[model samples]
Target: MDRDARLRKAVLWLKKKDPKLKRIIERVGPCTLTMMGRPYPVLLRAVISQQLSNKAAATMMDRVKEYYGNGKNFPDAKTLAGLSVVKLRKAGLSVAKSETLRRIANAYLDGSISDRKLSKLQDQEVLDLLCGIKGIGPWTAEMVLMFSLDRWDHFSLNDLILRKGIQRNYGIDENSKKEILEFTAGFSPYRTIVCWYLWRDHAAGI
Candidate 1:
């Protein structure tokens, strides 16, 4: 139940579930993936990163943070909610993303989305709650679950990098959603670890 124990358990489970993943684990060595920052800031970053490269997203986020608050401190929900849409746009957000950021900030201010509340919800429940917000879809919800909530069982089947990693590593041709889900089911309760490895594989150009 400690961090190291949980990571070890995940690796062992993943190695037992799939040979390809076992090889990946051997190559990757350890699970160092972790969540960073508070939920509000993480969610804000997620919103800003939508449909943009990581560098672009980070640059915009830095500007947005500096415009609203000191760059070292992420703006709280109340602060973000009070900002004008025009001001958010000046930070390089698209109109839609700016609106989404406002909605997320409002949700936090209204107690609709909170770390305490989300911590008590199941993965699917968290997804349902978050996806109900405007401009937050399944992928975004899953990102929150994995990166903000630190839910070990979460996976993003719609992620292109994950799909490519699976296909390339497992030596399969194009796979359907059903196939991917079924295949990944073997990694149940530790699919987040699986995703991390898949992402690493993609990043390594494997």
Candidate 2:
């Protein structure tokens, strides 16, 4: 099946498995979740987004891209890896985030990580590989797995928005991680897709 077909199949499977999710799918329309880019740039953007608001992250990314890519293209791993932390800091990145981006670019350049290599690895292996990087944790790795690797089963439990969405939609206490895990497990293998709908539902105030 194609990517859209796979997403449709996952949606149908989730709808049949859970009534809540079925309603969520109906209201949310379609799963718009998709891989945004290759592993290096995807992870690069993820690092830049950490601990910041979406608007802030996007603005900073524009600044960084303008500085390095003349405001058009996102720089490649070599270009990013060659940039000093000071230059990146000047481009609106914190010193720590600048260092992380450089390390990620270096990881891609040095063959420590790559799209081809990551595609061959399982979810846990990918998590292990990425989380070994100094600034990346499970949340960032999970985002890479979901968006970059297109691993539909992975969910970022650490995401506050997702947790709040579960609370509001499922009536599960946001503080009760185990209950949320159990409730979400019913959507297994498509939890990420279901979570996409849940996010939409929360955003819609339904």
Candidate 3:
């Protein structure tokens, strides 16, 4: 099956298999489930989304899109490398975000990494490899893995909503790695999707 279809199946299975998940699933409904474009652009978008509100990210992404290569479409590593950081910063990206995008582009063009390799890697492996690059960190790397690579087996423990959701829903005492992993284990292969719902739920105050 294709990735989107598989994701649909995964989300459905999560809701059906676990009644607790069903509550959020019913209210939040299905997610976008669409991840388009090549690896670098998607990763850039992931980086752009980091530590920023959705509105701010959307505005910055629009500015990036205004560039010849929309970060979503033609985020060619070579092209991005040649682009001006000052221009990108004027486009509304923070200094760190511009640097991160450059690092991602360099990693891709320098034969240090590729989408195929990222796809094959375990989540932890992907995290370590990407995080080794300047400006790439665990949370941003997880976003790249979860959204771009569409690795079903991902859990963004760094996400605050997921941690709070677990505490609220499952009554987990702490959001440690062990507790979070154990609580979210049942959502396997779709924990990121569950995280999305929890974030949405938290936003809606439901």
Candidate 4:
């Protein structure tokens, strides 16, 4: 099926899974999630976005593009790997992040982590491969699965904002991690859509 049809189907499945999610869907309306499609750029953006606000990440990425991308396209792995750590740091990356970026570049160049290979792997396999890279963890891997690979079932259980959104929507003081996962399990293959609404509700202060 097409993208819009798939999203609509996901929405319907979510609405059936939980009435709370149904309300959230009514409140939030359509999904606004966008996929960037390229593994290298998407993973690079995810790295830059760590612990930073969206605007800050955008600014930093623009600087990176300007410095290494000839002020136009995103730099390829070979180009980024060739740049000095000092130059990468000047583009607003922390030393660790600079190192991580170079490592990611090297991984891409060495055939350890390519878009083609990742696309053929299952979600858990992909996570294991990505998390093996220094500085990439479960959350980052899930972000790549959802936003880069467009996997519809991925959910970020470690996200504090998602937990808070769940608590607020369910009128609970606290929920165990297991409970949250169990509750969300009802959504199954459409859990990504559920996460989108939860994030939307959190952002809207609902």
Please report, as a residue range, the 10-residue window in candidate 4 with the lowest summed lDDT.
166-175
The digit string of per-residue lDDT tens for model 1 on 101-135 reads: 88998999899989889888998999899989999
Q: Residues 17-39, candidate 3: write the lDDT tens digits.
A: 88888887898877765565556
**Model 3 error, position 109 (Å):** 1.1
Residue 184, model 1, lDDT = 79
Segments in model 2 whose C-alpha atoms lie over 4 Å from true places: none
| Candidate 4 residue-wise lDDT, 137-205, digit = tens | 778788888888888887788777888887887854334788888877777887787788888887887
Instruction: Tell me the deviation in Å of residue 165 in model 2.
Output: 1.3
- In order of listing, the candidates' clash counts read 0, 0, 1, 0
In terms of lDDT, which candidate is stronger, 1 or 4? 4
TM-score of 3: 0.84
Off by over 4 Å in 1: 171-175
Using all chains and alpha carbons, the TM-scores for the candidates as numbered come to: 0.94, 0.93, 0.84, 0.94
Q: How far does residue 69 in candidate 4 sit from its true spot (Å)?
A: 0.9
- What RMSD, rounded to one decimal, does every model reach? 1.4, 1.5, 2.6, 1.5
Write model 2 residue lDDT over 66-156, tens digit each, in one string: 9997686668889989999999998799989999998888998899999899989999999999999999978888888888888888667
